[model samples]
Target: MTTATTDLAASRFALARQVADAVLFEGYVLYPYRASAAKNRMRWQFGVLVPPAWGPDHGEPSCQRTELVMEPRGGAEVAVELRFLHACRRTVEEARADGTFADVAALHLPDRVLVPWDEGTEERVEMSIPVAELEAGEVCLPFTRPAREETEPVPGTDGRTVGRLVRRTERVDGVVRLRADPLDLPYRALKLTAVVENTGDWTPPPEGAGREAALARSLVAAHLLLGLSAGSFLSMTDPPEWARAVVGSCTNRHTWPVLAGEDGRADVVLSSPIILEDHPRIAPESAGAMYDATEIDEILALRTAALTEEEKREARGTDARAAAVVDLADTMPPEIMERLHGAVRALREITEPGAQPVQGRDGPGLPGEEALFRPDTPWWDPEHTDPAAPHGDRVLVGGTPVGPGSRVVLRPGLRRTDAQDLFLQGRTALVEAVLRDVDGGVHLAVTVDGDPGADIRRAQGRFLYFQPDELAPLEEA
Candidate 1:
């Protein structure tokens, strides 16, 4: 019964849930916040749970089962909590003068179609059929729609069709049941979610409290699905009133207490954020947000290349406090200013153009110095094989054809490890050699144009090795 450990576990679960929530809305930073955008169409792209009915080629299934498993360490008392979106559906009917019914293809629900539970003027309720009921094959649920009619015609549809909202039901086509009673630790993990069918039909809900109903309505209309369940140990004391209230208010989040025994170990597993048509699969542990590492690296590199000189300067300034101190030092203290001047003078003297030291070689008395330094075979010599010359085989470099002496721009991306010289990105270089390594992989050796010194005697040489994608060929000079 370690309270501190249980509390820590609860906090971690809460934070993880928050991270998942952020992932859910990652694509909202677009011009139109709807899912029609090519970018936004990838719904539930992460945390996907695939059911058995759907294959890779067949695509996602409409209905599936999802489950979570929790194992408490020792004999600890544990509570489990869950949250997710519920699916609701409503039928739209067109009024006919002949008292005949015709299907309306263009009618869309602007808001959630409410259902009334009793006839005594009670508030309308949602179609919230329990999983147990669904598993029992009880498909029909009571649902009612408001007596509202579309004032304006739905865009892109025939104007002749006037539609009226009639009745609605909880969509059970996608997900049917979330089975947990059969599980060993049924109390710790269990949830039911249904697949949403019309993802493009509903609008996203606004953020903040008092919008659960709206959110639920939107999710059902969109065919978005989620489920949650919670269980607590009978021995453990009840949670605080405030905590219980918060849990009740937040439909998408839940909290539960865990009782730890002598061994003090409690493990809780939950379904992934998205459940596909297949059975729900547990998601792997993630480092905060889910994103492609390679994509991130490429983006970082591009952003760095796109930085303006002024922006680079600002970035190099470290922080405001340090920048302020340096700015103040410019006018204060004559001694400090004198030291700075001395430092600049010394730097200038050392970095002067001709200040490079020369190295002397021993025994350079070859019979013909020019002939010894020059290529033994001419460029036109058919029998000659010059390593410096481009190979007959064509190779792509950064999506462009490249050969020896081809001017190329390095695109080392944001990872310093990806580049031999971190400063080479966006800088022009020459293709000195294209060679095959021991593994038979093609490598491009390019010498950076503005590099201070030639890499003649260095082991790796002045030619930095790069993959074809890392260097873009420049246009003919």
Candidate 2:
């Protein structure tokens, strides 16, 4: 590739890396960010490619498959970059009187406390092939990280070695097999499949070897960054009608591929272990990586800052990245912190046909701007009609004023908003917010009480909406 062309590709990958990095460290550490925290005990949870033997028995997978469709022009080339984390075991040892070091769970120094932890090192495998070559023959990228150990001395105030940190990484072996075949379509589209398998020879110690034992042999946060040197990739999540069936024909196992990089340009695809929409980008409000995708940045930052000083210190000693997250949260600029609080991206117009108008101080919105409220809210009130100012709105549910925080049993009307509402038939939920529709309809945004994922749903702002009339309030105990 020419230098300029190579530079352009490098720039594209750089933009793509921001998102992939987020995925890489997700769940690497959780809230509180302390080693002693229960949540941090079980690590390497995301996209873990374990030994094939331990996978079936332990409910983990040994491989992740990513399949995507692309339109390749003549002489178009595709380059695949496999990125993942190789688990490393870090042990904190204290210096003995006789010049030797002994492994200790925690080495307490004047400033910080060091603890034993398993960390991940970034690894990648890259290869490129012409689309024709990929279609004709399969390509393999066999990757290996050799076992190695390193030690860094932790010096005291006087510069003497009070303790040392020893990090050992096991030999991790994996392979990525790439192949492509033409889809029988009117257009020139190719279906590409990339399978990543853990070919590590490490044997499972025993049935009770625990997850860590297998994690050492696994590929953590394994994902792919696929680039089309020429043509563009199609969106599997929202494909055009012509290629809808073709997307269905593409089989993806334990992986979700979505168009990435610049918006509207499908030259890059991020094959993630978790679900994501097309052209997904990081929220601009995020201050930094908190290593938890399910929770809001503001909440995590606030929670991290709220950690006790002792707790924070312990968290800082867990990993350098974890320490940075804590420090960012603790010392984040006021403006940045405020931005994380929230923002209204855009208003969807609920002023469609049969929709009602919402009153505003300036006598309802302009006909020009009124059409922006239809997508999300059934009612169009950006602070006037629907959600903007409905939080305080109360409706009588079983003769009780039901507003935010009111408990109610859902009785979704026969005209169901969603088929899944059937499962929530009589479940009790807490009203999170009250919203009004342009049609004068009221929606009670609620979360099911006792639901295992209730907190996560709340954190994700994913609550089920129901009309107030469909709810029967329960008195607070």
Candidate 3:
């Protein structure tokens, strides 16, 4: 078995954390990008590993285990950093007059409840224990009845029966413990498990709104994503013999299917060691701060028109840094430069209100200009005009210009280390569409000629996306 030095493994761990952070806050970039947005409030939707028996009545405790294979370089010691959601089972209860508990009940009262007359009079009552309060463990809260005579209860709770004027405590006393085994390099796999449990004595919330009920009994496991550190020498192409064996048997290089058997247990297995080449180790405290900068850039792009002069100045400063990085790194790939240039241009447009829109070489705009022009729309939408060609006229395949409906062949050497490289070298494909990514990079969407997988091709509309360098135009015989 191959081994990685402690430093190399640490760097890889940092990169994994970055990828996990990206997955964690992906939806934050959508419209109404505020924490208060209703859509934004629904968190931890990605990479959720719910138990098969996870439901209101069953509420059976489940554990999510992620196994990663790593080897230290030169017999050096390595430590892995893992991050994920820590899910805890929380109960939302409403105190009833009979000392019974109802999940999220409401209270109703007259517009003007004469203290003496309405004391015992039954009225519809509704109340909610804030999620934050519940996470903090036992606490009392006052339920103030709105001065309205409404016959209806709260939207998702049971309010038909009048409940007692008792306050309900919302507390997060549950703790999810994570345990990891050291990288016994002699063995090929390292395992980590997140065990979910409830701490305090509390009954599960009664099934009400589907969403509310899920939150009530669900155990939220935090930082469930796995991060591994391996030596710099190991790469996707030149992996150790053991790592290669593990990846060779798997369908995906980066993400694998973690199925929960009837026993309600699942395992996410990763064997492809992430190669960190000359990458710096980021301090754990600064990990989130780094992501915060990227988030700010996204927010600035969305509200470019509304930025004030001071904000515009700051945006320009960021543009300057990006430009300087691009300039200093002349050998940097075109994709990197294009991304930096896009940032600069985006900021320039905001700083210079009357500036003309940047045009592509061919004409006023490149093909599929709508995607580039309207950054607010869903960039990944298939219906959007292709950013690479407006009229679907021509696309560059392997640096050679080819028109739509043309034949192309996948070129080798461009396989992504993070995802499955579906297109094999020398495989034939049909040029179906040309699209531009958010970074202003051009991508060719092609359909494989002999692929018979209906689930991937028809059901998922799975098209092999390739950079111009990854595809070559088919030549006539």
Worst 10 residues of 3 by lDDT: 112-121
User: Candidate 3 residues 1-477, lDDT tens each?
Assistant: 111224433443344444444434333223222222355345444333233334335443333333333332333322322233333222224446675756542222331110101111111111222223222343222122122222212222344544323222123233334333344355534333333333433444355334433433333322332223222222334345666664343233222322111111111112211222222123322212212223443233334435444333332222222222222333345553345333222211111134344444333332322222223333466775553442354544434566567788876443342335643777888877666555355567777788786337745656767766666788845
lDDT score, candidate 2: 0.80
Q: Residue 230, candidate 1: how far off, in angstroms? A: 18
lDDT of 1 by residue, 396-434 (tens): 543456767788888773322433457776899878767
Candidate 3: RMSD over Cα atoms?
18.2
Better of 1 and 2 by lDDT: 2
Per-candidate clashes, comma-separated: 18, 12, 43
Q: How do the predictions measure up, each by TM-score?
A: 0.25, 0.76, 0.36
- RMSD of each candidate? 23.6, 10.5, 18.2
- Candidate 3 regions off by >4 Å? 1-37, 41-43, 47-53, 56-63, 73-210, 213-221, 224-245, 248-341, 344-477
Model 1 accuracy (lDDT, Cα): 0.34
Which candidate, 2 or 3, would have the higher TM-score against the true structure? 2
Pairwise TM-score winner, candidates 1 and 3: 3
